[model samples]
Target: MPTKTDEERVPNFGYAGFRLDAPDASVAWNLQRGRSGQNATGDALPHNPTAQTPRRGAPPPPLRVSNPKVLNYLDDRCRVHKETINLCKSVLQRKSIDWISVQRNDMSNPIHDVDLVISVGGDGTLLRASHFLNSSIPVLGVNSDPTCPDEVDELTDEFDARRSTGHLCAATAANFEQILDATLDGSRQPSELSRISVKLNGLQLPTYALNDILVSHPCPASVSRFSFRKRSNTGESSHLINCRSSGLRVATPAGSTAAMLSAGGFVMPISSHELQYMIREPISPRDADKPLLHGLVKQGQHILVVWYNEEGAVYFDGSHVMHSIQHGDTLEISSDAPILKVILPENLLKQGS
Candidate 1:
C-alpha cells in the first residue's frame, strides 16, 4: 500500500445543514383528516354533521395536501437543496476528504475537533452551527438553494415562496468545489468576526453570539422594562436610564447587516470590533428629554442592564438559545468575546459598500 503524501491528506471537516423537510405530526394529521376523513395514524375521525355547510361571508378553507411527496416534488427549493447536498458530498468523496456529518440542531454533537466546518444551507444553518463552534476552527457557508433573478422579478402564483436569501453563504452548488479547493489550499482568507460576551449577574455565559443578542419579555406583546448603564474601562459609570420598549438588541459588526439593519442600526465594517445596541420601539416620555436609544460599546467598556420584568429572556444569535431572567437580575453585554473565523466573499468584507 502506498502512503499518502502531505498534499493528498485532507483536513477533517464537519458538515451540517437543514433537512429537506421537517415532519410535523400535527400538520400531517390535519391534512389527512381534512382530505381523507382519517388521521395520520389511519384512525377515522368522527364526522361532523355541519362540516359541509358554508358560512356566509366566511373565507374558504385552506387547500389540503394529502400527498407530502407530491408537495416536495412541486417545491423547487427542496429539490435544489437536496441536489446541492448531493453534489457537495460527491465532490468531497471524489477528493478523498475526511469528513463527518452531524444534524444542525443537535447541540451535543462533537464538532469542536474538526479542522474546518462547512454549513450546507442558508444563513440560518450557519448560525445554528456557529453556536457549537469556537474561534479555533474556520467555517464555510454554502447556499444550498440560491434564488434566481427571474424568480425575484416575476410576479406569478407559480413561484415558490420559500426561497433562501443566503446572505451569509459565499458559495452555491455551482462553485462549491472551486471554493472548497481554494479554502483548503490556503489561497482563500477567512475573516475574524467579533462576538458579544454576555454575563448574567456577573457570571459569564458559555456561548458567545456571532450575530446579535435580544433582551426582551418572553411574550412578544408585552413591554420590556429594564434599566441600563454604561461602565467605562476606568470603572466610571454613567447615569442609570430606564426604558420601556418592545426589546433591546446588541449586535456585532457581522450581524449589522441582519436584524440590526431592519431596526435602523448602523451597518459597521465587517472587520470592526465594536458592538452596537439598539432599542426597539421605545415608548418615549412626553415630559422628559429623548432617551439615549442606541450607542456603541467599544473595547474595555460594557453595558449593565437590570431586568425589571417578572419574567424576561435573552436570545442569542437568533431564537435558538436563550436564558431566562427575573426582576432584579443583572445582565452585562460587552465586546470582549472570542472571535469567529469565517470564509466570506471579498465583496462582503468591503467597508460601507
Candidate 2:
C-alpha cells in the first residue's frame, strides 16, 4: 500500500454514485460486486488491463460508470460532469497525479497504491469509492451539480428535483482545482469521518457503512421481529429490547442526515463519535408494552440483534451490500470500523465544526 512516505504515490480520481435519469423515477445505483469485468478504459476487460492502447497524444483518462448517458437528463449536471473531468485532465497534465477510472461496482479493484481519492459525483460516489480504497487514503468529493436552485417550487417535490448533493459534497467543479492545489501543497487538513462495522454470526463482514445500516425483513411490506441487546464493556447485556417493526437502523453521526433522518431520527454533529439506533414504525399490541424504540449507542457500546424473521436482510449504506439473515442469526454492530479521512476545503471544515 502506498503511504504518505512513498514519493511515487499519486492521487487517484474517480466518479461514482446513483444517477437520477428523470425527476419522477426513483434514484438508483450500480450494485455490482467484487473485481469488475470492466476495466478503467471502460471496456470489457479484466481488473488490470495492460493491453488497452492509449489513443494518440494525451489519451483520455479511465472513466468507469454504468450508463454515463444518465447525465443527459440534466443538462447542467452533464456539463458539470464533463467540466470536472476536463479540470481533472488539466490537473493531471500539470501535476504528477495518476488517473484512475473505475466502475462503481468494482469494490475490490486495486487502489491501495493511491495517495488520495477524488470522487466526482455526490455523496453516493464517495461512499462507493470508500469500499475500494484503503483507510489511509483521504477522499475528496466534488459536487458536480452544485448549480441546482436552493428553493423548491413545491414542498412535495422530490428531494432530487431541488438540490443535487450540495450538503454532502465539499467542493464544486468550478473551484476544485484550487482545492486540489491546496491539498497537494499541504495547506489543508482532511476531516476524519467515523464508520460503522457489522458482524454476522460473530464473523466480520467484508464491508463497512459510512452512513447507516438497515436490518429488516427482505420483503419491504413485511413486518420484522427481532430482539437486540447492548453489550457493555464489562461483557454483560446492559440493555435489551424485543422489536416488531418495519426495520431497524444503526447510523454514524455522518450518516444521521441520511435515511435515519428521513425516518424521524436526529442528526448528530459531524464530529460525534457516538452511534445511534432507531426502530422503524414499531407495532404495539393491545396488552404488551412497547420496547424502547430509539437511543444512542455510545462509543464502545456493542449492539447485537437476533433475527426472528426467517428471510430478513441487512443493508449496509442503503443496499450497497446486502447480507441475508435467517431465523436465530445474530448481527452485531459497533463503532469499531476504520476511521475514514475525508478531504475538505479548510473553510468548509470549519463550517462542519
Candidate 3:
C-alpha cells in the first residue's frame, strides 16, 4: 500500500464565511432599496435616469410591499446559513483541530498556510476562496443552506429561488462531518480543475479565474468594442477580428457549464485544459460575413484582445472584482494558469468521470 503524501493530509484548516455572515450585511440588504431612492440633494430621482423625473414638490412614490412571507423565508435562510457555520465550528472544536476563519471579503488574511480550505457557503464562496489559493491547496465547499426535498413540492418559486444550489459544494451541514472525516483520513482524492490566466498590457494579473472572465463596457447598457486574435501553439496567428457586442466571455472547462453555457457555449469535459470564448449579442453589418464569434482556445494557445471602448472593464469570477480597461489596453486570456485542487462529492466525481 502507498503512503499518503502531505498534500493528502488535512493538518490545518482554513474556513471561509460568505456575505450574509459579514457585519451589517442584513441591515444593508434591507436598506438597499431606500438607499437607492434619493441622492444627496434629497430630490426624488427616477430609478432609470432616462425616465421622466417627478415634480420637486410631488410626494414620494409609495413603497413596494415588504412581503412578510418572503421576508420570513429569507430570514430563515440566513439563520440556516449561520447555523451551518456554527455546526462546522462545533465539530472542529470537538475534534480539537487547528483552524482559522476569515470572511470572503477579507483578502488581506493569508489562507495559503492551511493544508485544506473549507468554504462554508455555496459555489460563490468556493470561487472567492479559489482566488486566494494555489494549485497545492485543496478546497472543500460546504453548502450552508441546501434546499430540502419536501420544500420543492410545497414552496413557491420565489421561496425556492432563495435556496443555495451549491452546485460546486460537495457537502452540506448534514454530511459535513462525515465528509471531513473521510477527507482527513485520506479516503478521498481531490480533483484538479484548470483555471484561466489573464494578462493586461503584457503584465500578468495577480488573480486567476477558477470560473470565467467577462469583458465589457463599464455600463451594462453600453456596447463593448474590441478586436481579438488567436496565437496558436505552433506560432501561427489568426487575423484580428473586430466585434461590437454586449461583452465577451472566456471560460475554463470548469466554468463552461456556467455563464458560458447560458450564453450558447458548449460544455467541455471537466478534465479538458482548453478554454472557451463567446461573444454576447454581437452586431454585424448588413450582408457582412459573421466573424469568429465563438471558439475554443487550446492549451499553449493564447487569445489577445485590444480594447476599443473608451471605458471598459474586465470582471473576474462574477461582478465582485473588476479592473478598468482604457482604450487600446491589451487583454490576454490563456490556459497557462495554475490548476485548482477541489474535493468533489462522490456524485460530482461520478458525473465528471
Which candidate number would show the highest lDDT if scored against the true structure?
A: 3
List the global CA lDDT of all models.
0.71, 0.66, 0.72
Give the clashing residue pairs of candidate 2, or none.
Answer: none
lDDT for 266 in candidate 3 is 88
Cα deviation of 114, candidate 3, in Å: 1.0
Residue by residue across 63-93, what tens digits does model 3's lDDT show?
4434555445554665565577668767776
lDDT of 1 by residue, 55-168 (tens): 887764543446554344334444465567668767776874565443443344324556677777777777776776778877788887676777556623433334556777
Best by TM-score: 3
lDDT of 2 by residue, 1-353 (tens): 11221112212222223321111211122322213454332346545646565567764554454543323333343444555555655665576554534444534553565567767667777777666555787777777655445434442243233434645566776787787777778786688888888999999987778888999998899999998878866787755678888988999888998888888888887877889899888887323324356778887788989999879998987865798989999988998888888875554466568
- The better-scoring model by lDDT among 1 and 3 is 3
Ranking, TM-score, top scorer first: 3, 1, 2
Cα displacement (angstroms), candidate 3, residue 314, comes to 0.8
Model 2 misses residue 294 by how many Å? 0.8
Pairs clashing within candidate 1: none
User: Each prediction's TM-score against the native?
Assistant: 0.78, 0.74, 0.80
Candidate 3 accuracy as lDDT: 0.72
